[model samples]
Target: MAYRATMQEQMIRKGPWLEEEDERLAAFVTLMGERRWDSLARASGLRRSGKSCRLRWLNYLRPDLKHGQISDEEEQIILQLHERWGNKWSKIARRLPGRTDNEIKNYWRTHLRKKVQEQEQEILQRAINNAVNPQDFLLQQGDRSCEDDKSRTSSDILQISDYGFAASPYEDRLFDWISGSSSGINEDVRKHNEVWNMFSSSSYNLGFVSASGDSIWDYNSSSSSWNLDEDLQVVKQTWNTQ
Candidate 1:
């Protein structure tokens, strides 16, 4: 016949304490009164180790223990202390009257650390949204300026004629030079200029002109578009009566 092990000869318990163990431990603590843990378990008839008993007392069973969510004031103190001590949790815990180093460390990792990570992610996303695309942004501004110029009156068109050729002879010469030059201008720039000249000349009479009279039109040639009303495109024909 195999002999069953008695409770005294059983393997020492590890992990979660039972209600009976808690009751026995509490009773032992009430009589033996604190610390001296190595002998406390053996004397109390608990199947727990001294370290386990010490931890349970310090973390859960202490009379002054505050049980609930850590307050904001406690969280701030923990952060400040952690900065100074750098994971010296015991040192940090001392500042908080009832909190243990283990509890503070758990709070930092679970709640405070996660909150910081979320805030950092939000900041990074915002920065990406606000960030400018240098090439595209400059082109957008340039296109907007061109749109403003396209709304010019007839007087503005006449003013452009006066300023474009008369004020600067080199302006006409530049075009002539570009057209006839052996070294070709950039094809996109050439096309943009061609579009501008078509609008400005008396032959077309679009009656719209640029204020700056600056040449080099800004547009996305790939998405080149026109919003002209057909009535606005009327040609001026010279009449001869004999």
Candidate 2:
């Protein structure tokens, strides 16, 4: 029959820091300097350790600190820099104006870790799919012979110039589709937005065939996709009306 503990070990405090505490810490650090952190903490009337005082001063109390949500471009730059230098946040922070090393380091842990995990999961899923569909990997083109003439005509019409998804899994199929379209699907990009949207990832850009035989229609949006003949008809009617 042991009784419940009389009190919790520690009380949890949240919300914005108080103004008096901020002012006291700021004034003490400014007047006393870094080496005498213990003395400064006691003089300033803040019940914190020397190490905690130093961290708070550099990480939060500093004048040039950037706070709140990081923008997309900032995120991209951080990722690229991190790959180049690994976990050297201080080195990375020097390149980013108005940012701090600790802030950047925390952001990497919170955001970059999740992105890297997602990429790894996507790769793992691809590996699983390839393993399950063993035959799909070996077969380059499903209907190569039946499409020879059609492919040739599509090549003639689309004026297909350059393609980037050349090494894509669907290289042969994409080439065949372009060749068969008589409408000139001369898509000259490795990443075809139209076809790429159908699957998680695509190497082909089979968006459309331009009249000039040098352009291809692309599917670049979430709301639209290709339906071949029927959709093509609807598109033509809509285009004419517009």
Candidate 3:
């Protein structure tokens, strides 16, 4: 953190702010609210740019500056404000009480994305774990919805491996999810996916009928069709010789 003003107060010319100069600026803003950085700079006899003064005061000296990782709640406001206004750090900073827009933007770039990725990975891992050794509840769902329909079975059920789930919100619910932009895309994405799954799933329906029902389908689409009464001869040819 470079000092915004020179420290000596040597009545010196401006090159950069020093430690002592920072102390003076702090004293000035403390004595009076930072109404005008230009006025503060001149009155303090620092002779620095008003923008510099403002930035110094706001970014550094203002009795506010909540440093060290903005809270999740504060982060939401920052992202929302940034999205709506777009990179006007000053404007965004105003909406925040003690946070700087630069801090917010930087955090968004470096930390936020990583945080989101980590969270997503955790969710994906959780889902994968659940899929393998699914709890009685999810298992019951499989039993009732998929297995009950003799025409289809959980044996042919799709795994997370079969088709990766993207985090984008499925449309019908975007109206609900985007409404909470402050809450963020990932949160809404989960809700969106849940809703999509709820709607898309009732009874698993196979896209193509196997010409032979007894064949062990490898999910090969081109050779997918097999006779209903007979084992899929194509699949049987490879696995079951009898």
Candidate 4:
């Protein structure tokens, strides 16, 4: 028990620090320029470790530190930079001025990471839901698109095929509707292409069965036509026959 007591006596202070301790830490950092934390802690007359003193100075006592909650812009930057660099908090902190690596790491752990995880879970659930009942999901999206027409620009809204066929028969029809020379087809084509690009880049299988049995999305120069009505009519007639 004597060895344990000696160890305890030698142990540096931990947990919440005092106001005077904060000042001494800050003063030591100001004078010493923060290069040597152990020396700074000794000089400051604090029973705290070098690591603790350094963290307090960098995260709290620093004059250039930004107080208050992170703004939407900062949050967005953090999310994007984290996506690119993974858990390299210091690298991410460089992009966000007045923010410490420790602060960013804490913020990500407490808030942003959970939000991202929840979003991923939601997307996974949607994918599963889509797999189980694709027609229902498409119809729901179609209905929502129609209902929210006034809120979105022409290009921002999800476009469904006007042809009132079931999901299996309407896959190619939807592609044609986007690519064709209909009044709003150009905007629809742009949005559809964006979705297609996202899916392709992510390698997400959307399970789009081609009604034509050739290719549903043939946007190549030779295959693309402003007028695909004749082919659509043939598809319609074939669907009617079946």
Instruction: Specify the highest-TM-score model's number.
Output: 4
At residue 105, candidate 2 shows an lDDT of 94
Candidate 3's displacement at residue 169, Å, is: 28
| Rank list by lDDT | 4, 1, 2, 3
lDDT per residue for candidate 1 within 93-182, as digits (tens), equals 654556788898899998887776786577666555768554344444444655645644445544544433232232333333333432
The model with the greater lDDT, 1 or 3, is 1
Model 4 residue 203 CA deviation in Å: 20
TM-score of 4: 0.50
Q: What residue runs in model 3 are displaced by over 4 Å at the alpha carbon?
A: 1-16, 31-33, 113-242
lDDT of 4 by residue, 1-242 (tens): 99996785587898997999998887778788978888887777798889999888888888978888987667876786576457889866754557899889999999999999997677668968668554455456554645633433322222212211222223345445433533442354343444334332211222222234433343211254423566456544643464
Q: At residue 150, what lDDT does model 3 achieve? A: 65
Better of 1 and 2 by lDDT: 1
Superior by TM-score: candidate 1 or candidate 3: 1
Clashes of each: 0, 15, 15, 0
* TM-score for each model: 0.45, 0.43, 0.38, 0.50
lDDT of each: 0.57, 0.54, 0.53, 0.60
Cα RMSD for candidates in order: 31.2, 19.6, 18.1, 17.6
